[model samples]
Target: MLPFALVASTLNSGLVSASSYKPRASVCNGHAELCDRSYGNVTFIGSHDSYAISATQVAANQDQNITTQLNDGVRMLQVQAHSYDGSIHLCHTSCLLLDGGLFSDYLTEVNTWVVANPNEVLSILIVNSDNLNASMYGAVFETSGLDKVSYAPTKATTSVADWPTLGSMIDSGLRVVTFMDNSADFTTVPYIIDEFSNVVEDAYNAVEDSFPCTANRSTGTPENQLVLTNHYLDQVGSSTSIVTPNKSKLNQTNAETGTGSVGQGASNCFQIYARSPNFILLDFYDAAGLAPFNVAAELNDVSAPTNTVANYTGGDGSTSTSTKSTASTTSTSSSLSGAGPQFKSEMMPLIVAVAVAVMAGSGLMLA
Candidate 1:
């Protein structure tokens, strides 16, 4: 199938899987940058960035040369994006969220693209920050009633899950995202975990609240899944199934898996979501349970199990239950204003002033 692409939009999907790349400089003869490719040991060079496109670049298809390389046996679409606009997302200012289009519209487009371009575009790569400067992005998925990808703040006093980006992604089917415990004793890289849960819930309630009623994690698989593909994303046996996650319960082996390299998970995020066997709950439990693997970069020299989208794992571990509800599939977005007003800023912005002084006098890298 001709992979589902995020085309026809006004803004270019930015550059696929890159912020550090300049087309002319990165291309070697007629190929993509060596760094931009490589999913585990699989050698990925399909559609690079599917979500973060810029208009002019979009029109030109700067990545098509590599796409041609994928002509015969393309199985994954690798995407890459930085979380913040550098100076923007950090300071407390309102700005456009990353998923630039309307959440409903965007979701609809994804479904359409998946249908239109089957098997080729399987996964999504999210190398951006969790908090965008926009609120609409946050509101639609995590907030109450909005249709855009607006940004919300990772407020000084906000709950981690309530951050605008997390809420929206979760609402949009992000199943799991567990960084290192932040306090684990393992010497792993600080990583980022983003599991795409296709359950697609209302930003207003828990995924359990919307349609089916699945239990929380620690217990076995939620009862809501056995009969359905609720949280456990992949089928019993498919090429996409993961081979060596925690260890092999099947062969009774415990040789630990390392952050071998950036594997096929990120290289196939968007394309795989199209089919049912194409999904996997995103998670980042410390193989050693030491720290959160820092997922902010594309190829961080962090540690083993480096960064993956939602690749399969070997062995049929456990399963969720089947205690569900008769729910409606209608779209319903809510607003964050209902949670009371956004926090009013307190101090007169001393941090900005201080940062400026330090940068100006110290020749700091903050610029």
Candidate 2:
């Protein structure tokens, strides 16, 4: 037997060695099987117009705030950028319709989440409605410190197969992937790469309940680019051109399996494209709770998260309390139905000017 001092020293040394031998991360995005999968190959549920959140605001595309959405397992965040008050703002159609505040503030909020959750990989898709320069967006990202964790691609365009795996991104500490729908100058800001160059998107603002899958927008080769299916249902307003989320169909639209369900849309897209959709963007995603996540899990061939958010009662009649229910409860009101802001007599001139600018340049009346 060793002396008392020697025994204590040996135990301490063993503890140090054990502590130093830290195992690498084996799980990513809540799945061990996804660690080895490429980022482009993995399916991520996205919140369309994620910044537009309000209980009473009719044009609001999302119910919960950004933090709530991220906490509930939305891996991708899609926001529309518009010029307002001489700065980039996250607005729905026109700022007069729905102003979500400054883009930098939004980025700062996202950066906070990214720093806190180091292991999670996030994707940000910016719809450059104003076609702002990449430098402008990059400046905001830099100011917010989000650029520190952002992934910069070597080239402007990358084939879906060439993207790095989730494990590699997590290990490197540079995990946030960003894309802009327009004016993504790689030479100026390589982190915010061109979206259409690497992704093909299905037509947005679906008026029909069928939710047909088609490659409506893409500059990259469809076969090699990542597939982004717009899975939200929209209803025509007083005019055929005006459209808003069909809140009445939230249950059926976001169900795992049924007509116009996210599951059906994903399966249809998979069958048509011969590959799984990389991102499925949904409006008011919390309405159906884990249904969208389950659909994504099925597409990725992985188990879905067991936690529940919003008012999702299982088919067996087992009701689970919402992780975040404040905003969702208010969203159920019948008064929440409008494509844009109610016009005011005094604000008409400014609204008309902004509307003309948006419609003439991008024709994005609906997000």
lDDT of 2: 0.74
TM-score of each: 0.21, 0.81
Which number leads on lDDT?
A: 2
Reference-based lDDT, each prediction:
0.22, 0.74
Per-residue lDDT over 1-367 for candidate 2, one digit per residue giving the tens place of the 0 to 100 score: 1011222222222221212222256888888776766776788999999887754355667766677677778999999999999999988878877778889988888888789887899999999999889999999999999999999987989887778878778888889999999999988899998999899999998867676678999997888888899988887645234566777777778778879988778767766666668899997787777888887776666776787665432222223334644422222211222233344622453446446645765333443
Could you tell me which residue pairs clash in candidate 2? none
**Ten-residue segment with the worst summed lDDT in candidate 1?**
54-63
User: lDDT (0-100) at residue 367 of candidate 2?
Assistant: 39
Error of 1 at 343 (Å): 38
Model 1: lDDT to the true structure: 0.22
Model 2, runs deviating above 4 Å: 1-23, 239-241, 311-367
